[model samples]
Target: MIHDVAIVGAGMAGASLAAAIGPRARVLLLEAEDMPGRHATGRSAAFWSETYGGPAVQPLTTASGPALRDGGYLTPLGSLHVGRAEDDARIERLLADFAGSGVELSRVDPAAHIPGLRPEWVRGVREPSCAYIDVAALHADYLAAAKAAGAEIRTDAAVTGAGRRDGVWHLETRAGLFSARLLVDAAGAWADEVAKLAGVAPIGITPYRRTMVQLRTDPPAPEGLPHVVDIAGNFYFKPEAGGRLWLTPHDESPSAACDIAPEEWDVAVAIDRLEKVVDWRVEAVERRWAGLRSFAPDRAPVYGFDPKTPGFFWCAGQGGFGIQTAPAASAMAAALLLGEGGVPEGLDAERYGAGRFPAMR
Candidate 1:
């Protein structure tokens, strides 16, 4: 049977888009794993900060804020970007770049907020709107809503090959063959491979590994401590429950598209960086993990259809901001796919359009 649209990944990107499409179209979500969201979505150190994804992505993040807040998936966890005196220029540039972008940023003394902060880390910029996200709950809700809205989901359906004939896509998956009028590639790290299998030009969507570690610290991470990030983009950490701290070195190691694991070198680097930023003693390395973040050549999300391939749509390359921007991105992608709704207001549709990529054009 032919589905109206078949998305090749049931992670946040695919699930949210499926939910947004609702019953307006017959949608099918194909998962490569035993269940959905086994990769990036499930492993995200989830946070929703308007400035987290840079200026190009700020609009979508801002637009998605309301939906997440209304759904009770967000809790206050302000972000503090701190740095040494020499990094003040980065702070000013950040404020200048996003001056009119609706992301709130203000100067603050680093020591006033992050206890035991090194004195050399003098300048700081605070983004009070940043908050933690309930990623698991959000992903699960999208999947459930999509299912309830009449969209079908099949797990262990890895697309081994894809071909288009007579204006219809025929996908051969591990589970079985499926036919769809329109094929959507929300395959996360495997997006480019899926495009290639469909005889479409690959968009250079590269996956990068990011490392995270939870530590038991001495003098314990203080209660109500803001998420502290370095202005140089080297590290970020925040207080977790039981007086522990969740930290990452902001490592973006280029990697293959597969199940990933944290490297000891990266973990050591995180600890080294954390030591320089604060006086906290590392009592134990409680937990460590890694996840993949895929990006297009330009880093902004890719939406819209292939310029040269009919019935083929591109909805991958969301990178690390996929969760925070899911609501807006999915809504916009759904509107583009089904032509059933208007693009979210103030969204720079062209920036996110597939046509923007020279390869797609």
Candidate 2:
């Protein structure tokens, strides 16, 4: 059977976009793993921060807030961007950057917000708009929405080959053969490979590994501990359940597309950074893991169709902000994929268009 759209990788991007496009078209979601979101989506820090992907991505995140809150998928969990006296200029610049971007940010005392903060870390900015996302529930809801719309979901379907013949995408997957009018490359880290298989030029989407370490600290983390990020981009930590802290060195190690393990050096760097940030003692390293964040050379999400490849859509390069921006991003992607109506007002679709890439241009 030929589907109107067949999305590669059933992660957040693909699933949410499928749900957005399902009602109007016959959609098929193809997953390589036994389940969807087994990678980045599942391993996400699970917080929605407007400042996360920089000013360029703030619009999308801000626009998604209302829907997430309405769906009851967002819980009130604020964020704190902290720094030392030397980082005052950078901290001020942060507020200046998003001055009129609709994101609510205010300066505050770091020590008052983050308990046990070292004296050196004196500056703080509160982004009250930030919150925790129920990732698992959000993903499940999108899948359910797509399913309810009659979109077919196929797991364990690793695509081996892909080609367009007579305007239909003929795909060879581990699960079986499939045909679709429009093929979407949402394979996360493997997006380029999927494009190549479909006879499209590679867009230089590089995959980078990020590490996360869960620590059981001497002073159990306070329940209200905000997601604390460093102004220097060194590290960030937030309180997890049971008085545990989830920390990351903010390391972005260039890596190949595959299941990744946390590098011991990264874990050590995280611990060292954490110790300097707070006075709490880390009693145990409860858990450590890593996930790949793929990005286009420009670091902006790539949406819309390929310039030279017909019936092929590019829906990868989300990096770490995919889930937070999913609600709006998927809607934007759906508008483009469908070729009619439903475009979110004020969003510059051309900025995220696939044609923006230098290679394509």
Candidate 3:
């Protein structure tokens, strides 16, 4: 098969990139699993908030707002941050830092709003702009848009090797061999390994494990409930589709690149934190799971061609913000690979490009 661009991994990053370049170029999207988003993408907390990541990632989140709203991928779920008395300063800093970023937040005593929440254990900051994302629908929409624009997608087509030959890149996958003018690495946790196969220098991408547990409760949760995070981010809980609540300890332990599973210790930690904040009693744990969040040395995404490897491009190191930044990140990746003058209106490539990590080069 011959294509203009061959993309590895079919998560948000790869799928969105294929969608962006679909009209202008022939794209081949390859996924290792039987279905796309089988790993971290499928296990996301699925919330969109500009204040989640720091200033560096705020631009991408801001740029994606329009698309998220217009595409009907967001539901107004709001968000709250609760801290103990000692965390008042951190709460203040969070509010002050994100004020200019369009995050509307206010401080309040826990007793004023959350009667069940222990007053001695909590102080609260609320942001009305936070919302829940329809992750499955959003991913499907991107795939549909890419297919509609004439891009080819193949599942279980894991790329085993990639190399330049006769001024073109040859990608060997489980299904078959593909030739392309350019190759893109969007393999998430395995990004560095993919780069090694393509003869590109490793970029120090590390995958961290995060676990979440679902608990069932009586009385059901109120509709339109906001997502809540502890001031220390030790734990968070959000209402799910049914009467259950999805909770996490916000744990980010260093992990090997693989299909991660939740640890008993981590689950215990989450339960302990949840018990300290709210008065709700957990009847039972419905389920538990874990996923990997990959990060580069600087904790920023890398989007550009490899300096030493011709016809090889990078679009990795997204961490947990992959879904939120997909739109702009994909556009930026495609534009840079095509040698376009600059990134799209809202995104600046200088901060996100591979050049920022000279040590990687």
Candidate 4:
């Protein structure tokens, strides 16, 4: 049986898109792993911060707030951007750029907010509207909803080959063969590969490694501590349960698509950077893991159908904002998939279209 749409990946992007499109189409959400979200979606330190994706992505993030809250996926948490006294220019630029962006940002004394802030780190911006995303819950809900909507979800069904004949896509996977009218490339870091399998030009959606380490600290990380981030992208940290802190060096080393593991050097760099920001002592490193954050050349997400490929859709390059922007992004993607009627009310669709990529064009 030929499905209306078959989405590759089954991570946040594919799962959410399935939930949105299943009501209108016969959908298939496919995953290579035995379970969905074992890649980037499962390993994200997700927070709904308007400042996280810069100006281009702020609109999508902002528009998604209501839906996320309604779904019980967002938990209130302030996002603090701190920097040294010498980094005052960074703070000024952030304030000026987002002055009217509706992010609820404000200047504040860094020391007052963080217990062990360094003396020289006096400048800061706080996004009071930011909140932590329950990624696991969100992913599960999207998958479940898609299933409820009559979308077929298949795990361990890795796509080995794809082709089109007589206006239909024939996909060969480890599990079995499936046919569809449209193929959506939502395969996180492997999206480009999926396109290649379908004889579509690759969009240069490169993946980068992001490392996160959980550390046991002295004085115990405050449960109420805001999500602390360095404006210059050196480091970010927030409290985890059991007095541990989830820390990252904000590292973005380029890598190929695969199961990623944290580099020892990157882990050490995170600890070092965190030490400079906070006076807390790292008693021990409890755990360290890494995930791939894929991006297009422009560092913005790519949505919409491929300009040249007849039945292929581009839904990759979400970077780190996939979870935060999932609600609106999926809605926009669904509208694009179903023609032009339900375009999420306020989102500008042209910015993320596949036509923007010279290679795809």
lDDT of 2 at 313: 94
Q: In model 1, which range of ten residues has the least summed lDDT?
A: 352-361
Local accuracy by lDDT, each model: 0.93, 0.92, 0.85, 0.91
Residues 1-361 of candidate 2: C-alpha lDDT, one tens digit per residue: 8999999999999999999999999999999999999999999988999999888788888889889999999988899999999998999899999999888899899899877889988899999878889999999999999999999999999999998889899999999999999999999999999998888999999999999999999888987999999999999888888888889999999998998889899999999999999999989999999999999998888999999999999999999999999999999999999998687877888989889877886
Q: After best superposition, candidate 3 residue 21: deviation in angstroms?
A: 0.6
Number of backbone-clashing residue pairs for each candidate, in the order shown: 0, 0, 1, 0
Worst 10 residues of 2 by lDDT: 340-349
Could you tell me which 10 consecutive residues in candidate 3 have the lowest summed lDDT? Answer: 217-226
| Residue 146 lDDT in candidate 4 | 96
Clashing pairs in 2: none
Error of 2 at 356 (Å): 0.6
Query: What local lDDT does model 2 show for residue 214?
Result: 92
lDDT of 4 by residue, 203-320 (tens): 8999999999999998789877899999888999988778789999999999999999999999999999988888999999999999999999999999999999898999999999
Give lDDT: candidate 2, residue 105.
Answer: 90
Residue 353 in candidate 2, Cα distance off native in Å? 0.7
Candidate 3 RMSD to the real structure: 1.7
Give candidate 4's TM-score.
0.98
Ranking by TM-score: 1, 2, 4, 3
